[model samples]
Target: MSEPAVSVARYLATTTAEGPGLRTAIWVQGCSIRCAGCFNPHLFPTEGGVRWSPADLAARVLAEPSTGLTLLGGEPFEQAEALAEVARQVRAGGRSVLTFSGFTHAALRRAAAAGRPGVAGLLAATDLLIAGPFRRDRLDHERPWVGSTNQEFVVLDDRFPDLADWRPGALDRVQVDVDRAGTVSVNGWLDTDRLDALLADL
Candidate 1:
């Protein structure tokens, strides 16, 4: 039987920065919360990454000495079905899944409460969901898992159950910047078609 499937801009075999050891990372495509300024704007608009069956990704994670799937993106939450399917593969193979999203924990909860598109299934299978958008000004290199201080690493492991179910409101977006000759400048979210075109051309 094949493993499962996932949507992604690219799936790097391993990354040094995304959590625990020997992690297989999947960078998904697309984003909606285009803050005033954001980095990786290049990946903002793209969606439905290259098709790979669950067995495909799971095989890699299983073959490697890794413990799970570490997800990233333009926004993993947007591609809920793909993510859930990927998570199912990871869990089935006895591996864990760690996901990242732009929506804050509270915001995701609210969306799910209102029956938003992709919130429930995605969160249900995700082991760790790092929430909130990146803020250039609040960027903290010290933080291991997030880009800015406003973003938080939410640990969901049977503790504080129904975390994704409770919501009051949406969370705020943050700024992102690039330094040029000691000058700080902001770059907002990039259009998906443009980004994909550029990558495809390359």
Candidate 2:
């Protein structure tokens, strides 16, 4: 039987802005939340993205020397099964996993407790989970790895012990990448006004 595939909108081989260290970032393609002022509005559509097998994607992520893997999306929880498999593979290779979700940790815990398919598996595979829907009004640029003040950083495992000592208010965040095709992409949090100015220039 063939391995399950994930709907991937895009992926960055390595990025420091997404997590604590250099990490591989995978952006899945679909979201039901549709939060206003979402940074990646293009990813909201359920359709339109390349389907990649978990094993293949894991291999690509592991090819580079990364401290961890960061999963974000349209919504990572929406495609939990495939991501869980990828997380499992990456963890087996000794890399930590960080995930971003639109759902709260409490909600995910409830889903896991109720025996929802993939929810428990994905949660188990994650070492850290940044949860909550993006609120444009609550946009926060001071905190690391979160888009808004309403979101939270939940530690699921002790792999990243130093995270406890990390302080907020770092301004040196965000990364801009221009692919060979000249398509520009931005990652990480930017306050509403700055983001608007950046977008206006683009």
Candidate 3:
């Protein structure tokens, strides 16, 4: 048989609260980490997402000027193949790629050491990387692209990994009013289990 077809779960194109500029955000699907307070447990159920082609994704991202691409959950790095292709397209088109992950930079490095494919390529082509997951205990309202203090918005360029823009943070966090009809229009990651429990309680 041919090699197993690599499939990646692609969520709807959404926006970010604190990143660079206008961005075409892709929320990928699937994760097994099961962090107790994961904001996006809905992503853990992979069956709900659609499969977007790398080229199609690239086209939508490029349609706007001064807009970069931001890769979000279920965890962008979980499927290296998906991210690497995204990186390649963005780089080739002279745009930047930003990604948020539940995995820490050190964790990704460790995975690469253990022969994880696509990490190097993805990192190499990426301009920014927001590493680590959101921590309920470390929540900080005044940071960039991060919910908790533990999460960092890292610029992965070889020359300036230690730099922090320290720019005035953008107002990207959002609140939603879910109706009884179950409309789910919101921003940032959602803690699915907690949400379900809350919904059930209501």
What's the TM-score of each model vs. the native? 0.69, 0.91, 0.75
Regions of candidate 3 where Cα sits further than 4 Å from its true position: 1-18, 158-166, 169-171, 175-184, 189-202
lDDT minimum window of 10 residues, candidate 1: 166-175
Segments of candidate 2 deviating more than 4 angstroms: 163-166, 169-172, 196-202
lDDT of 2 by residue, 93-176 (tens): 999999999999999999989988789999999998989999977766567778788998888888776443336543436787
lDDT of 2 at 108: 93
Residues 75-126, candidate 1: write the lDDT tens digits.
Answer: 8777676667667777777766788888899988888888875578678877
Error of 1 at 179 (Å): 26
Residue 80 of model 2: what lDDT?
A: 90
Question: What pairs collide in candidate 1?
Answer: 3-54, 3-55, 4-53, 4-54, 4-55, 5-54, 41-190, 45-192, 46-192, 136-175
Worst-scoring 10-residue span by lDDT in model 3: 2-11
| Residue 161 of model 1, lDDT score | 38
User: What does candidate 2 score in Cα RMSD to the true structure?
Assistant: 2.0
lDDT of 2 at 176: 79
